[model samples]
Target: MEGKDTDQIPLLIPYKLGQIRLSHRIVLAPLTRFRSYNSIPQSHAILYYSQRTTKGGFLIAEAACISRAAQGFKNTPGIWSKEHIDAWKPIVDAVHAKGGIFFCQLWHPGRVSDQSFEPNVGQAPVSSSDKQCSPLVDGGVEFKFLTPRKLNSDEIRPIVDDYRMAARNAIEAGFDGVEIHGAHGYLIDQFLKDQVNDRTDDYGGSLENRCRFALEVVETIANEIGPDKVGIRLSPFSNYMDAGDSNPEALGIYLAKSLNKYGILYCHVVEPRMEVMEERTECVVSLGPMRRAFNGTFIAAGGYEREDGNNAITEGRADLVAYGRLFLANPDLPRRFELDAELNKHNRDTFYSPDPVVGYTDYPFLETII
Candidate 1:
């Protein structure tokens, strides 16, 4: 009897989200770049994306604040303005020209902001309560701990409407879909996590109440841009942006069941872990619970490698894999993976610098022309 061909490699297959069939499972994760031109995605952004396009792949654009108050960072993009929507059209067009699908991640920082980023002049950041988000204050010149003002019933309605408007704006900007930035302890996550939400109103005090805000945003966005074009990101136990849930498991169950009502395309779940291990195992490791909760196509992200990514699909834990830092270092990451070429290491120093030419477009790729 011939020796068993143990080397039969499992074919790395493509995944689908509703009608959108991806040629590969590699997804470009939503990464924040403070390189927006005048708080709007610029021509450089179009060039930046054009360089990173992969055949049959999808790119989740960096978080764009849904409203003025949603902006906490110095130079992040926003979808609330006409200029922002107009500016993003070319970028979306460029991505489509390369046969790639793009989705803009809509976000609002809420309490995770400073006075400089406030909407109303000199107003404090808003949240579910008066709790301070940051645990540290470097200094007045650098950074300081900020206590957020509570959002009253009157203000909550318009804030929820902002998401609906942002969704409409995303469609105007020529995006394939919109992903709600409900992760990383931002506004929606802040409302979801009990630690930050101390409200006695209908929006808080209980798990269901705490989730009310996020659910509203989801429903509103779905209604504005059709359910098939809407998706969300959720990190049940992420400590990065000070988001914490009393019971992550219960939160996942509740969120999953609630989100399913919208008929959205996918629920992107970030796998929480410590080590910088391979992507496949690390991605799915935290998803066993989410997979049980969410019945739709699931996109798993955070520190994934090719092998670990393929395992996620083969194991049925994830429908797609979102790659972050890897895409930054290798513009042709999907091609590099197909060829099994060595990847370029990313420079940590220039990760967030103002200099446009350095980390933004300096990475090289295989010489296909040669």
Candidate 2:
């Protein structure tokens, strides 16, 4: 891929995301691979991330829990302690050695978690509301969410501070930046989605109120690390874990406009027609409006293939396209897209499998393909 012509593919073209110049617009989406053991990033991740690294390419690491209270799933990495921060250093250095720009995706699962994953044992996870998220069953996997205790008004500041600390930890771990996980019915989305947030506080009820918690996190993170090193992933169009909005378009537009106040490095949005269920019936199919409203680098994700991804960048639907499953199976995803080569199929069974190398680092590169 070093010397081969890019063939004028829109996704292969160079673009600048803040001061960080990317050689291409194909992003490695933040996916929960469930390989990190005991809430700390394992050594296997070094090769896993390094396999996908390319010169000047951007890769967002798997979502790392911002604090003990924020954990919602098993085996997911964390950024809350000295051990967690130290564990991520070598992995970050591996990606940097390959000249890839890595961003640690900091998240708080909030109510999306269960009792077993909690640090305080049976203590309920915190969220904007006390409503319990429905259990998730996909691809022969089942996850039952515990009823979350609603955060008291005064309790909100501490969680925000956790996010700030996580961002600082990400930078100290040698990551180029951090992407806040505000998408997919996690802690932040719990506030944004009216379907689950049944509150009448300063953080719920109105659009601004619902979004207040999110913007505060943005402001605090931006102030802690600097706006240029910050980005956020949002999913206003889809509902997972029963966190649906009454009006997604308005919610998306509101958040997009509000995010401009902080001037974050980029806004990565999950594309429509996602794993949306009852919300899918709403037929929300475009990210154009949100992309237009946000006055920064825009990254569109979810179910994009080579042609459509190229079209998105060229037609200005987004400045970049993030690939999840495709990239997970094809470590040389950028090279494959460049050559229009056959991609290896992804095995769903191993997506969250406990095996370290079976599906984690076993994906083949073009050179090794017979």
Candidate 3:
């Protein structure tokens, strides 16, 4: 933003991502707005995603639970049924209308969930192990976590199929692709991170074993759809939701190499724990090795700004950089970055509000603000 010509900006450089030739390198990181009520995407999302669409830009939708049992928090979208697929069709079309490439992020909360968010008659939340998450403390009031039921050897294939089915549902709903939510201590991460995965079965113990479940999901989804239509988000360096690994760098590189076997679209890796999901400082580990190991396009996310993003691309650290909060507040994020325009400060309080227009689509575009 400071030193060079706007035309020379690395973020503005066009790059081919698998099948699509993108107009820019900035991606809209999947932000879970919690605005989809009753587990169904609402009409309001049309304006929300459409406002952010730029010709040939990429946007990953918020985490859509693979099944009813996968719903961790309230009001998140689901893709496990035909009704859900129909609901997403319009929203997907809205982005496509503007020539934007949209990818649905499929996820399962696993142990991060509680029975309270379940559909009729609550069943126990399942994970790789029976260990429960520690209660979250907020203003001295605690929300305790129930002991999650451990998945038996026989039950793993069904959940793997859930991911495969969700990916197919997303494509049926008119999405360009599906990104597996393998990051953020979700179902896949619960198995990848050794801290939570205490299984003595084939899914635990050795690093390769811990990664088996994730690979299965990737392979199933790739086969169900196609490898070019698949991507997986991973954060081996993150300790969020109590899913930290002992050797994160190794974990990161290993997953990157493993993913090459399927030749998925891209690897979206978050910054280390301290920089993840927050405004940041530098992290101890660098993503260079992971980026190098990943044969497909590599997207680096978490706490990146215009200058930082440009630097990452220029330095060949990543093929693309994702912006979460920035994109949330500034729908015309790529244009704003191109012009070095001032960004509207985001209201953190209303970020997760259920109101459709409050902090959701009310953020003005660059033209209106000027």
Taking all chains together, each candidate's TM-score versus the true structure is: 0.90, 0.96, 0.95
Q: Model 2 segments beyond 4 Å from truth?
A: 276-285
Q: List model 1 lDDT by residue over 318-361, tens digit each.
A: 88888888888889887777666788887766665666778888
Instruction: Name the TM-score of candidate 3.
Output: 0.95
Residue 306 in model 1: shift from native, Å? Answer: 1.8
Task: Kindly state the number of residue pairs that clash in model 2.
Answer: 0
- Per-residue lDDT of 272-303 in model 2, one digit per residue for the tens? 67643213233535889999999999999878
Error of 2 at 52 (Å): 0.4
Q: Clash number for model 1?
A: 3
User: How many pairs of residues collide in each model?
Assistant: 3, 0, 0
Error of 1 at 180 (Å): 0.2
Lowest summed lDDT across 10 adjacent residues in model 2 is found at 275-284
